[model samples]
Target: MLSYGFWNNKGGTGKTSLCFQSICFYAHQHPEERILVIDVCPQANLSELLLGGLANGGSDRLLARQGAVPRATIGGYFQQRLPSPYQPPAIEPLDYITTPCEYNDEIPENVDLICGDPLLELQANAISTLANNNIPGTDSWIAIIDWIKDLLQPLSGKYDVAFIDCNPSFSIYTQIALSTVDRMVLPVMADDSSRRAIQNAFSLVYGLKLPSDIYATYAFATRLRNANRTLPKVHMIVKNRLTQYMGKASAYAAVLRSIDRDIEKLMDSNPEIFTFEALNDGIVDVRDFQTTGVVAFAKGTPLYSLKTGKRDVMGQRVTVHEDYKANCVEHMNDLVGQL
Candidate 1:
């Protein structure tokens, strides 16, 4: 399967919301294909958004209280002993998947979720410790870092696309997700903080040491002006949550220009990893659909699915206008098309 990670070291850039929307849009557009989402964030916000009460507590409570049941979570998979690089773990990805039918009988079975666990934070630290102490030639670090990739090997042909949502930190969990993804999507808001976060992300990626031969190939690509090979290429640098008003857009022009200049500088220094053409081709600007976003979150549904009229959300009554919902759907469709 083609895997993509929606992440940024900076939080509150709408990473989870965008990731959720992409998965839902892709699943709806391709009903015949299977789509999977793995929530690696300790907060489990995406899991809670997608699965609702079942993610935090519901059926799991009854199952645990009634009898012994396996902990069906991404973190639970890492609790076992670390395997050698030559040996793959005997774990089934399907066992941990939570289907839509599990949450509600009326929902379709197109998308599945590998729920996240708060305990993953602890597991990440342990893995980091093991990786830090491993000898250079032992290949143990590869196995440790490639744990998620190996875990998903069995499902490579089963799903069309797998989207991973990671925490806004450089923990071992984030590294595992980064190492496994074919494409990386960086969601950045129109602000100064997001710009600094982008710079930090590039520095971290550049510091990572891969195998010598792979590193050599990457170095060689840097010399070739037309080369297009890079590990986990930045598929897009999404300019998210832009204001709808022209005045605000004019005010943000300087910040956007600054970000562009910074990206250009990075490209000049690291052509192999970041290219001018790639940056230009991957940049996308999306507007902030405030009303639609609030309604979607409150109703526990995608923005496109919001209906008109009054509805109860989290014990509060709210009204959704038809024009607003229609506008949100249009923007969402355009966003998905850009992806």
Candidate 2:
């Protein structure tokens, strides 16, 4: 399966929201292709939105999945791998998969999920320790980080594409998911910090422009290269939550241009780090979805499936204007088109 990882070094870029909406849109657009979503973030918000949103008992449904006999979640899969971190295990990947449509009818039938869990917060230390284990000629780090890739190997032909919603941090779980990624979707906001985040993400994932060579041996990119494994190329940089200030004269324009210039510089220096040869083809800007997004996210409904008018969301009334809803749908269509 071709895996697309959604991530950013900095938080508050609306990464998870963009990821959730993008996957739903992608699944709806490509109904013939069986889709899989892996929620690698410990918060599991994407899993909740996938199962059912705030208005539809999403939290309750997620808890039930976490409480399953074998526990059908990413944490569950990790637990199984704990005993055999360095060696391949016989556990079935499908055993850990859940059909989101089963809980939320609004989601497409072709989409499956490996739900995220709160247990991951507790599991991080153990996973980190395992990766750092000094075993003789074992390359324990690589073996530990490739857990997700190993899980997906069994279902090679079953899934056409996979979307992973990653944690903001460079957690071991995120590394596990990124290890399987063919392309990365990085979402950034319009600000100077986001500009720096672009550079930081490249440094973290591809070992580009580090302060010194002293840290090169400890970088994720270095380890991947040493293992003879290719790192994922940045496929799309989604400029998310954009406003009208994106125009040339807008005050935010300078920052936006600076962001573009940074990418342009990266393109000139390390063209191998990206999939697209041109910056325009690789970057996308998404407008703020406004109230339309509020209602859709609250109900865990894809923007395309949402209707205009007021809807009760957990006792609060949300009004989704027709124009706003249409705009959001169009934005989603444009965003997913790049995928």
Report clash pairs, candidate 2: none
Clashes of each: 0, 0
Off by over 4 Å in 1: 53-68, 81-87, 104-108, 135-137, 208-230, 246-249, 267-271, 274-280
Among these predicted structures, which one has the highest lDDT?
Answer: 2
Q: Locate the minimum summed-lDDT window of 10 residues in model 1.
A: 220-229
Residues 185-259 of candidate 1 have per-residue lDDT tens digits of: 888988899988888777555543335655544332231222332356667777888776746447576777788
Reference-based lDDT, each prediction: 0.69, 0.90
Best by TM-score: 2
